[model samples]
Target: MDPKVITYYFADDGRIPNHPSLPLILYPGALKEKSDRIESIFNENNWRNSWTNGVFDYHHYHSNAHEVLGVQSGSATLQAGGEQGTALSVQAGDVIVLPAGTGHKRLNASPDFKVVGAYPNGMNYNLRRGEIGERPQALEEIGKVPLPETDPVYGTEGPLIELWKHKERD
Candidate 1:
């Protein structure tokens, strides 16, 4: 199925300096009743190094690699793009793709809210809480992150590849 991609451009918000090339992608209900199918898809698409857990409650971003979060069990309200960002209500079978430097936090969740997260090429990730001192290095790292060869949910021809590559050209 196709995903509904959402793009967010955040300025140097004095805290989190989000990415320029990639946008946040939301594939709502893309895995409905098939939450367990995510691991295999991610692995097959080269999005390896998977883990299952709940999202963090406090706002944070990854500076090393992009992340894909598949909602495996329950529902939650997630705040993306830092403290002043938008709030999103996500449920089971939904997937959220966050580019490097995009801030995210779990505002609240149902008791069973579980997610499977993975990185492309099994890339190791770094945690940054938008501290003032971390901005310079984080921004540099964000710019250096390579684009994923394939979309986590959809394959090579998905919106992620098209949009992200388009953004790079512009």
Candidate 2:
């Protein structure tokens, strides 16, 4: 058996390049956690500033971009394939890493759930909107993998609540 290989490269101040997703999920403010350097293998490299809030929301992964969500406070579940796909539970100080081409969403189990993540190779979060537009089959509703759950968290029928707006602050 071989051990996983790990390499370390330091960027002064530590930050990664930004890979913006098309059609933009959440809002600018919600995604405004910001970065400083690019980790040879991570997203939003430095974790000094953070993107957080008290709300229930969902997101999908980019075509070739995976994500790492580490819970620093409260807890939540990463639900894939609608309501019965894969349910990964997480609590304070726990880490959940989703590989590239994986699609999933989060359920805010607490009034205030916060997480810090590190993504290597910056973010291509997903292929361009044009790319998805090219593939109607892939773009046809995420969560069809049918995550296995009867009434998992964030699994209900109702109006999606509003959280943040797409406004920028200077």
Candidate 3:
């Protein structure tokens, strides 16, 4: 089945410095029948340095790399875009693509919750809590982080690429 794409935009909000051009992308139930192959799927699409774990409980953002997370085992309530962001519930097979600098935190989760996360081309990622000191530099890094060559869950022609590109052109 084709996955439905959902998009959201989060403003900078002083501290988090959410991506200015790209909106967060969610593909619900994209991998429902193939949750076990999530890692391989991301790797095949050039999203590498994969890890399997639950999200951090505190809000944080990555300044240097975009991130993709595939729900592998259970369910979670994740807050995206810092304190003013949206809270989303996700279960196995859900995939979230967060552009660089988008804030995220795990509000709650099932005991068996597990997700596989990866970055484009195995790019190194930096963790930055919503601290006052991480301002301009984080903003700069976020602007410099390039778009991923391909979507983590889908291949080259996924909704992610189109949505992000369309936003950039606006």
Which order, best to worst by TM-score?
Answer: 3, 1, 2
lDDT of 2 by residue, 1-170 (tens): 12121111111111111121111121112122221111211222321122334223554443343344555567677553223345656565444444333445676477567765433333333432323343443333221222111101111220111111222211
- Model 1, 24-140: lDDT tens digits are 888888888789888888888889999999999998999889999999998999999887888999999998899999999999999999999999999999999999898889988
| Prediction 3 TM-score vs. true | 0.96
Candidate 3 lDDT (Cα, whole model)?
A: 0.91
1 versus 2: better lDDT goes to = 1
Q: Per-residue lDDT of 47-85 in model 3, one digit per residue for the tens?
A: 999999999999999999999999999999999998899
How does each model score on lDDT? 0.86, 0.33, 0.91
Error of 3 at 14 (Å): 1.6
* Residue 168 local lDDT, model 2: 24
TM-score per candidate, in order? Answer: 0.94, 0.42, 0.96
Top candidate on lDDT is 3
Q: Residue 45 CA error for candidate 2 (Å)? A: 8.8
